[model samples]
Target chain A: MNQFNIDIEHTGDYAVIRSDGYINNLGGEKISEECCRLLESGCRNFILNLEKSPIVNSIGVSILIELIERVLESDGKLVFTNLTSTIAKTFRIMGLLQYAGAFPDELTALDEIKKM
Target chain B: MTVQEIKEIMLTVPMIPDMELAVTKTVESLSRFIPFTGDQVDEVKHAIIEACMNAFEHSRSADCRILLVFKVGPCKLTVEIVDHGKGFDPALVEDPKIENKLFKNVRKRGWGLKLMKHLMDEVDIVSNRNGTVVRMVKYADAYRKEALNESV
Candidate 1:
């Protein structure tokens, strides 16, 4: 099984990152690094599709929070899509849902971001 | 080993990277006997990860080892993560907030214990100069009550 990998696709103004595998510290850093590249290129909207990568530790989730801070500082939007209920609940408990938007899937997040 | 001994799995892992994953793999094997739902197993795995990470992060074990025990009970599965390292006061650990961590220069990585406590049904922490052991329990769902009873 793939330990951690990311497939980034830029659709119009938003970027969709499909993650496959466990979101450990390294996996989290990969997502953050990819987002950093997108941010530098002036992409403001992000859709993190974690349909395949559902499991995450606090360290990895903590990195996502830091990413949210960076994205917010840049006046950009960061949203998560296709989160397992376990991850959704974990996000809620960690107060991540407050900082970042969560949608059911990539299409929904992209549509919502387009509306914004 | 008796049948009772077979139900209890003890693992000792070095304090290295990705050791938590090893524990999770063993946990998956244990699921054959315990009817953990998809969500419950994920919660258990995540809690185990947090507990192991806590040992690696805070304990600073001189021996660089973590001892884990998985016990199958009548209605619950108990996971114990033990470390022989310098322990800190859980009371002193600050509760991290996104609001405080985002804009301000505060720490944002103290959610391990909170996540473990939230994921597991019950969490007990015993820490001192000797070591720290995080004991987490997950009660089986009512869907398969007799399965566990018959197995144990």
Candidate 2:
């Protein structure tokens, strides 16, 4: 199986993490670590693009919840862009949508984050 | 139709996190033989992964193994995930949505069992000191109804 990976890009005042592959334990941990590293570097706003990741288990969702908490603790916002319908529904059921917002695309997410 | 074509795939892997991808992919591949819609396939994939994760989390020993059995029938798909772990009562898991509101920071631990039950048409769990087996089923008739509703 191919291991999951993330590519980070810093744009203006925010950072974006483009994740690929299944977001399980390995992938989730990597994403969390990357987000924390960015957070430490004074990057408060983040947009996570999960377009390449089609599968995510509960463990992965937990990792995302932790990231959301971390971002909120820093008084920043985390948004998800390009979510599959399945993942969108999963997030709704898991109550992540209540705290974090999801946009249709990266540009829309960036637009919303910039306004915040 | 004559006798229903039945296909089976059995896998035993160590209780680890990364193995979930392979297990879910195998389930996805086996489900292709059935007449499930795209959404149905996703639901089955999610449910199996949840079951396997539960097994990984609750297994007794570090070297414990998880068993996944996929049984495909003409009209139904059945998955059984077995684990040699100390089992807990499923009744103890409160509804995540309700819990989400009561707790300040929403929890991530309790959503797996609820999701498995919601996604699959049928679910059965049997656990004891020996091991745990989670059986999940999805029927083609449900998809037929969905197709009918979509066309209507």
List residue ranges in candidate 2 displaced over 4 A.
B1-5, B61-63, B98-107, B141-152
Off by over 4 Å in 1: B1-6, B143-152
DockQ of candidate 1 against the true complex: 0.68
Question: Best candidate per lDDT, number?
Answer: 1
* Tens digit per residue, CA lDDT, model 2, B1-152: 22553677789988765777678778778877887878788878888888888887876744578888878886678888988778777777677763354336555566788888878878888887778889888877656565335545
Model 1 per-residue lDDT tens digits across residues B30-145:
87677678898888988999999989888888999999999976456888899999987888877776677777776567898888888887788899999998888787787345
For model 1 the local lDDT of residue B116 reads: 86
The 0-to-1 C-alpha lDDT of every candidate, in the order given, reads 0.85, 0.81
lDDT by residue (A21-84, candidate 1, tens digit) is 8898898999999999999998888999999987898888888888888898998899999999
| Residue B74 error, candidate 1, Å | 3.7
